[model samples]
Every structure is written in structure tokens, then in C-alpha cells.
Target: MKITLDRVNENFHFKLKNERGHIVDVDSRAEFGGSDLGASPMELVLMGVAGCSAIDMISILKKQRQEITSFRAEVEGERVQVGEAKPFKDIHIVFYLEGPINEDKAVRAAQLSFEKYCSVSKTLEPTATIHYKVVLNNKSL
Candidate 1:
């Protein structure tokens, strides 16, 4: 559960590597004197929430024998000024699932993820309010 970061340039650009050797490029926005080369740290936090929840939901569905065709999630966060830094005040996620899945199961899976399963959301729960909605086969559930 360790990672490393190396400067990619003189500015705020960096390359992050997980213990498994996976790489994620990181950088600040152009307005922050970065090269706009990769996702910012805050952006990665949102991505982490999305990815963590997606994995939980998918695992739940798979165990329930649901046939999933595709899945995608869109995450948005609102930031509030906290001293000299801006932190997320609220985070919203929209999960789009395509499959011959049961609607009730999908909804329950999402509920379980936010309320119990997703660790990333839980980590941010104390500071940020997290909300999510599920859309299954173009229908909101």
C-alpha cells in the first residue's frame, strides 16, 4: 500500500507510481503554473471515488449473477475555500450501467457502496458530502 512520486518537470508536474508499478501522471492546472499534462490531485480524488464505487458495484452485481455489458461513471465535485486551500464540499456521482440487470439490485448495490462498501467515499465522508444516482440502460433507478 505504498506509492512514489517523481517530478516530471520543474513545475507542478509529476509521475506517480504505485507499488505494483502502475503509473499515473499528475499536474496542476495551467492557471497554477503547471504544464496541464495530467490530472490534478483533486481530480484524482474524484476519480478514486468513482473507481472505488464502480468496483464495489460491479463486484456486487457479478456475485448476484447479473450480466453486465458496460459501465461508466461521471463524478463532479464542488469545492469550498478552506483557509488557503480549496477542498471538496460536495461530490456527486452518476453511474451509467448497461446490462440486463435487475433494477432493484442495481439501486441496492449503489446504496451499499455509498453507505457501507466504498472506502474512498468513506475517507471523504467526514469533510465532503457524497451523493450518487444510478442510471441503468438509460433509465434512472
Candidate 2:
């Protein structure tokens, strides 16, 4: 997969385009002289993790014949300084699922996503610790 980045302005704002012609805007934090036009690169990394795992979990659950009404995932990351770069130290993902879904199936879907299926999480696994929790119908599973 190839991606191209073009500067949007004289500053840190840029637009990234993939081979499929999808676009994602990227910018630095305001403190770094950016205008906050879009999400920062670090934030996009977290987004990738959330998105990848969401797809995996949803696909797994669907294949298992679970009835899903709504699903949402919240991802939070803690960063640590490494030389001049602040990289994520750990990431916590909370999945909230609603519907007449089996609790164990929901939990297993999440487990499979993080432990085996999600490529984005696996890419960050060496540097960042990944943790996930599943909440099914307002109850932690």
C-alpha cells in the first residue's frame, strides 16, 4: 500500500492520500505551530488501532451469529518520552456493545481482535502495551 502526502500550507498541515484515493488530513499540535486542521499523527495511530480492532471484532461477531445493535470503542493512550519523541507507552481500549448478544461471544471477539486478528495493534505491540475490556449491555464482561 502506498500513501502520498502533500502540504496543505506552509506549516505542518498536510493531506495524505492512499492508492484508493481516500484522503486523511494530518496536522501537528497547536503548540508546534500547527493550525489544528486535523488529527495529529499520534492521534491517528490510536485511531488506526481502534478502527482495525473494531473491524475485526465486528466481523468475528457477525460470523458467530451474534445480534449486534450498536458498538463503540474508546481508545486512550499514555505517552512517554523517548529521547526527543513522545511515544505511546500503553493504550487502553474499551468496547461498548449493545444488543441481544452473548457476553462470552463478545468477550471472545475482542480477545481474538487484539490477540490475533488486529494488525494495527500487533504493529504497536512491541512498543506499546495494549489492553482491552468489553462491556456488553452496560455490564463489564
lDDT of each: 0.96, 0.95
Least accurate 10 contiguous residues by lDDT in model 2? 28-37
Instruction: Report the poorest 10 consecutive residues by lDDT, candidate 1.
Output: 8-17
Q: What is the lDDT of residue 75 in candidate 2?
A: 97
TM-score to native of every candidate shown = 0.98, 0.98
Please give the lDDT score for candidate 1: 0.96
**lDDT score for residue 22 of model 2:** 98
lDDT of 2: 0.95
**Residue 95's C-alpha lDDT in candidate 2?**
98
Each candidate's root-mean-square deviation in Å? 0.7, 0.6
After aligning candidate 1 to the native by TM-score, how far in Å is the CA of 93 from where it should be? 0.4
What does candidate 2's lDDT look like per residue over 23-111, in tens digits? 99999878989989999999999999999999999999999999899999999999999999999999999999999999989999999
So what's the TM-score on candidate 2? 0.98
